[model samples]
Target: MDSSSVCHAEHVPSCHAEQKRSIHTGWRADVWTASSLFLAKISLRPRIEVALSTLACMRVPVAFLLVLALPICKSFYCYISETLSTACMPVVVFVAPLCNAAALASLEALAKQPDISLGVISHFPQEQLPLHIRLRLAAHWQTASALNTAELLYAAEKMHTYFGKIDVLLSTNEHVQEALALIREKFGIAGMRPDVAHNFRDKARMKQRFFEHQIPCARFQRLTSRQAAYDFVEQVGFPIILKPLCGAGSVSTFFVDSYAQLEPALAQLNPSEWNVALAEEFISGAEHSLETVMHHGRAVWQSVSRYLPNALDVMQNAWIQWRIIVPNAAEQVAYSDIRHAGQAALSCLGLETGISHLEWFRRPDARFAISEVGARPPGAQILTLHSRAFDCNLYEEWIRLMVYDQFSVPTQRYACGVAFLRAQGYGVIKHITGLDEVMRECSALITDVQPPKLHATPTGTYEGDGFIIVRHEETAKVEQALEYIINTVRVTLG
Candidate 1:
C-alpha cells in the first residue's frame, strides 16, 4: 500500500488508483498546510493578501479557496444561529477497542468523509485494523490501556504532533466514553465534559439524575457494602438485578431471583467502595431501545427498536436466539409517550450534541421506565436497521453530526429486523440447517446474512455466531419474518 493513499476495505487491489488520486490531492493540501502556518505567524492583512496571491498563482480551484475560508464561514454561520473551520484539515481522534466489528465500521465511516484528517487511538496496534483503514489514518497511537488517563493524554499529544490542533475527540464504544471525555477536557476540546459523561457512564449517578428530574426509572441503589446489598435486596425484595456501576452491555451483570441466588450474586459482585455495584428492582416489561440525536441540548431526531426479550434474558440463556425489530412506523403516536420521556431524559443527562442509545421499558400497565442510556451510537446492528429503514447511511450521518454539527435527517422507507443465529449445544459449529427454506420463503425480504463458519467456536455473547437482516415496508410483516427465521434456522454444535 502507498503511504498517501487509502483504498476502501472492500476494494484493495485498486490501491494504486487511490494512491494516485491522493498524490494529486496532496498539491492542494501542501498549499493549505504551508499557507496556514504562514497565516498564523503573520498579521491579518498580510495573511489574507499572501493567501490570496498564493491561491491565484497556483490556480487553486474555487473549492480549495472555500476550504481556506471555512473558518470565517463557520464563524458567520454560528454567530447568526447562536452558532460554529479551516484549510488545515480538522483532526479527529477516535478511541475504541479497534478489533471490534463496531469500531471497524465506525472507522470506515469516518475515513470516507472528505477533507478531515483522521487519527486513531486504541488499545490494539494499527495492524489490528484492515490495511485499508490503516492507510487512511493520518496517524495511529496505541496505548498500553486505552482507559488510562495518562496513556490517553500521551497518545493525544503524539497525535497532535502529527496533525496539528486536535479539534474533536470521539468514540463509539460505551466502555471508553468517559475516558475520552476526560481527554477532551484536558485538551480544551469542545465536546461532552467529564461531569456530564459521568451521568451517562455511571449508572448510580445516572439514576440519581433520573430521580432528581422525576423521570420514571427502575428503583436502584449504589451498593457500598455487604449490608447495603442486603438492605437493597430487603427493600426491592426478591428478583433483583446486580450490575457494575459502569458496565457496558450484560457483561458482569447478574439476575438474582431468590434468597439462594443472593449469596452467589454477592460473592461474585464483591461490593466495596472502590468496586461498587448497583442493585435495582427487576423490571418485568417489554424492553426497547431509543436512539436519539441531540443538538444544542435538545433532541433533534430519534428512532426506536424492540428487543424480542431483554438482553439479560438472552445472556442467561445460551440456547436462545436473539432478535430485534425496527418498526416501519416507529415514530407513530403509540411511541409519543416514549419520545417525550426519552427527550426529557437526554436533556437532564446533559447530552449537548451527539447520538445516544437509551434502553427503556414499557410496563404491563402501559407506563414507561428508563433503564439506562449510553452517550454514543448503539451496538448490535441497530444503526444498520435505521439505515435500511430510512434509506440513508446512519454511520455517515453520525460522523457528520459529531464532526461537523450537521445532519441530513433521512425519512423512514421500510421496517427492518435482525435474527441472531445461535447454535444449540455449542462447542463448535458442526451443521447449519433451514437456511435454504428461509431463502426460498423470505428471499425478497432478506437484506444481509452472515453465516457461521463450520468448526468455529461460539462467540458466547447474546449476538451469537451470526445474524440475518430482513427489511419490509410493514411492521407486522417484518416481525413475522423474524419469527419465521428463528423457528426455522438451527445451528447444530459438536
Candidate 2:
C-alpha cells in the first residue's frame, strides 16, 4: 500500500490500525493521553463509587466474584463512553484567513449548525472571528503562516490534543487546498486526497487528465522553457493563453494575440524548469461556469451561469463592467450535454465530496470545452445568486454537504443576475451618475443593491467596486434589468 493513501476508521481494522500507528508520540501523545484520562475521571467517578459500595456490602465469596467482574465492567464503560464521544458531534476544522469575505460567510454557516464541533486554523487571531462564530468554536489555532504546510500540520496536531480525530479538514481557499489535503492524509481524515487535489490545483495536470479521459477541452502544453513556449505557439499558432501552473481568478493570466505580445508576457512569466507555466490555445466563444456538488465521487446537483463578455475581456478592458446571469432553467434539457460532460470530467479528476466551480467555453461550432475546475465553492457572489434563484440558503447547503454528507436539492424558482459597478477611469471615485433612474426603472426587479462608494480605489478585478443582484421568474426580464443597470448606472473617477 502507498504510504500516503488515506486510511479511515470505518474501513477494515487494519486501516484503523494504520492510523493508530501514524499518530505522533512523546509530548503531544502525552497531552492527548492526559486529556482522555481527565475526561474519564470526571465521567466515571459516580459509577465507580456505586460499584465499590455494592462490593463492600457483599459476602467474602460474592465480594471476590464482584471484584473479578469489576475490570470487565470498567472496560465496557470505557468502550461505550469513547463511542458516544466520537459519534455525538462531528469535529470539523476550517482553515483560512478570517478576513476573507467568503471565509467569513462560510464560517457563519458552519457555526449555525448546532451539531458540529467546529475548530478553525487561520493566520489571523481568534478574536478576529465574529463573536457568534468564536463562541461556537471548540478550539482555534492561529499559525504564523497558514499556507506553510509544516505550520498547518502543527496546528492540526495541537487541535487533535483536545478534539481527538478530525472528521473533516477543509479550506475554501484554492491556494490552501493542496496543503490541507496533505494534512488530511497525515491524519487519515476522509476527504479529498493529495493526488486528487493536485489535479484541481495544477491546470497542466488537469488538462492532461482531461486528455486521458477523452474529455473535450482546449489544447494545452506545460511550458518549462522559452523554446518550449515558442514551439507550442508554432504548432498551435497565435492567440494563445499563458498563466502560472497553479493560479486563481484572472490575476497574472495573459492573452497573447501575436508574436509581438508573446515576449513581454514571457518576460513577466519567466518560465523555466522550476517556475513552470501553462499555455493553451485560446478558445474564442461564449464562456460560462458550472457549479456542481459531488457526493461519494459523483455529481448530485449542478447550476450554470453565463458571463456577459467572459473574464479575459473584462480584465483587458478596464472600462467594461462585468455581469453574470444564472438562468432559472440551467439544469433543463437544453444544457444536458455540458452537464453530462462536466460530471464526467469531475469523476475523472477524482473529486469526492464538495462543491466545485468549473469554467468552460462554448465554441463557435456550439461545442462545449472544459477550461478548468476549482475544488471549492464559486466566488464573486455566484453562490449568492444561486441562493436567490432557488430561494434557499446555499451557504447552509454547502455546509451540510461538506460536514454531514447530506444535500437537499433546491427548487429553482427564479432567474438571477448580478451587474458589477466599475468606475470608468483611474483614481478614487469622485462622482456617480444615473442611479436614481435605474431604481425608478427597475425597482420591482432589483432584489439587492450595493452601490459603489465615493473616493474608494477600484478593486481592479472583474468583480468591481460594488454589485446589484436582480432576479425574476422570467429569464429575459432579469437579463434586461442587468443590461439596463450596466448601461445606465455609471461610476466616474477624477
Candidate 3:
C-alpha cells in the first residue's frame, strides 16, 4: 500500500469500518477491542504530542517515521536490554565541555538509562564517533566555534529523529548562541535565551548586572587599552587581579602586586584579542562555591563547597594544594548564606531552570561576596566529588531537573572532599612518591587517587595535575586526612 493509504488505514475509526467495507463479516470483536486499546496506549502519553509535532513540519513520511521510531525503539530496547525503570522520563540534551574526562565519566554514570545524550561543541570531530553508534545515538555534537546556519539546520534535522520536542537545551560557549536560537525556533525547545547565555559568558556584563542588583562583589573596572588599564590600576591601587573578560579555566589571569609590574602584564595582554580585561579589587580569605539547581526561577537544590587554599592562591603558587569540602545541611552556615545570595543573583539575572555554579569569597568577618557564576556545572570533577560523597548523582539530578522538573535531594549520609595535587616546579614528571603511605594514613577517608601521567607537565594555572577524592561521614576526620594527604604526598618533576 502507498504511504497515505497506510496512514488512512491505521487511523480508521474502528475495525468495523474495514469489516463493513470488506466481505469479512465473521471477524471477532476481540480483534477490534485489542486494536483500539493499542492505539489508545500510544496516544495517551506526552511523547505522542512531541511525535505529532515533529511529523507536522516534515514532508517526507519515511524520514518522519524513522524520526518517530527512535524514542519508541529506545524505550523498547531499554526495557528489554537493561534493568531500569520502564516509566517514561523526559530526555535531556547535555552540552558539556570538550576533553573533560571527569565530567564525561560522571555524566555517563548518572544517566541510569540512555535518556541523557551528550553533546560536545569544541575541537572534537564528528567523524571520530564510533561507527557502531547511530548519529542520533550520539549526542547531537557540533563545534561551537564553527557553528553556522548549516550546522544548526543539521542539528535540528538530527534531533528530529529521537525527540519530537526537546524539554531543555543547555549550552556554555557564547559562540553557540545562533545554534541554540535555531534549535529553539525549529524544535520548540525551552531554555535560556541566547542573550542570557551571552551575558553569563561575558564577565563585564555579568558583573554589571550584579552591581545594578545591589549584590555584594569585588570592585571591578573593565579595560580595553593599556592606558585604560593603567588608569584603572591607579584608581583601584595595587594588589588587584587581571583576567581576560571571556576566558575560562583561569588562563591569562594574573595578580599585580606592584605598580612597576603593571606595564609588563599589560603588554602580555593582546588588545585586539583579549579586547577587554577586568581589574578587580582582590578579596582575601577562604574561597567557596555554591552549586545550585533552579526550577522555574526558584532555587530548589543547593550545596556549598569550601576551597582549601582558595582558587587564586592555588593558581598563583605551583606547590600550594587545595581541597573541596561539601558539608551537610546542618553544618553549612556559610554555605547557606552563599545560597541566599546565589538565589538573589539568579533572580536578578532572570535565570530559570538549570544548573548554576557560583564562586564566592567568605571574609573572616563572615560576610560573603559574589565572584562569578557559570550556567553549567562546576569544573574539575566537582560533580564526581559531589556524587560519590553524597551517594547522589548530580549529573543525573541535573538531567531529571531539565527533563522532568525533579531534583535529587541527597540524604546527607556522608561528607565528601577532594585534594588536588600541585607540582613543586615546572617540568616533566620524574616520580610520584608517598602515595602508598598517604593512602594508608588516610585509608578511612581516601577513596580514589588519579596518578600523574608519565611526562606530565607541571600543574599550573587552569591545569589540574591530578587529585585525590576522599569521603567520610565524619567531617573532621575527612578534613584531617585530606590535610595529611596534601602534606605527605610529593610530586617530583625532572
Best model number under TM-score: 1
lDDT by residue (264-327, candidate 3, tens digit) is 7777774433487777888887888888889898887787888877777777777777788887
Q: What is the C-alpha lDDT of each candidate?
A: 0.81, 0.83, 0.65
| TM-score of candidate 3 to 2 decimals | 0.73
Error of 3 at 52 (Å): 37
Q: Which stretches in model 3 have alpha-carbon errors above 4 Å?
A: 1-92, 106-111, 114-122, 125-167, 171-187, 272-274, 425-427, 455-463
TM-score of each: 0.82, 0.81, 0.73
Which candidate would rank higher by lDDT, 1 or 2?
A: 2
What's the count of clashing pairs in each model shown?
3, 0, 0
- Superposition-based RMSD of candidate 3 using all C-alpha atoms, in angstroms: 13.8
Specify the poorest-scoring 10-residue window by lDDT in model 3: 20-29
Writing each residue's lDDT as its tens digit, candidate 2 over 1-494 gives 33223222122122343332232222322444566678767867788778778867864476677788899889868866764664578889999854676788889899899777787888765557776776666656656678888878877887676567798887778888998899889889889999999999999999999999999999999999988889999999988999999998877999998989999999999999999999999998999999999988878889899899899998888888879999977435467889899999999899888899999998998999999999998888898898899999888898998888899999889999999999887688888898889989998988888899999988777788888999999889998999999999899988
lDDT of 3 at 347: 80
Best candidate according to lDDT? 2
TM-score of 2: 0.81
- Cα RMSD (angstroms) for every candidate in the order listed: 9.2, 9.1, 13.8
Give per-residue lDDT, candidate 3, residue 133.
Answer: 25
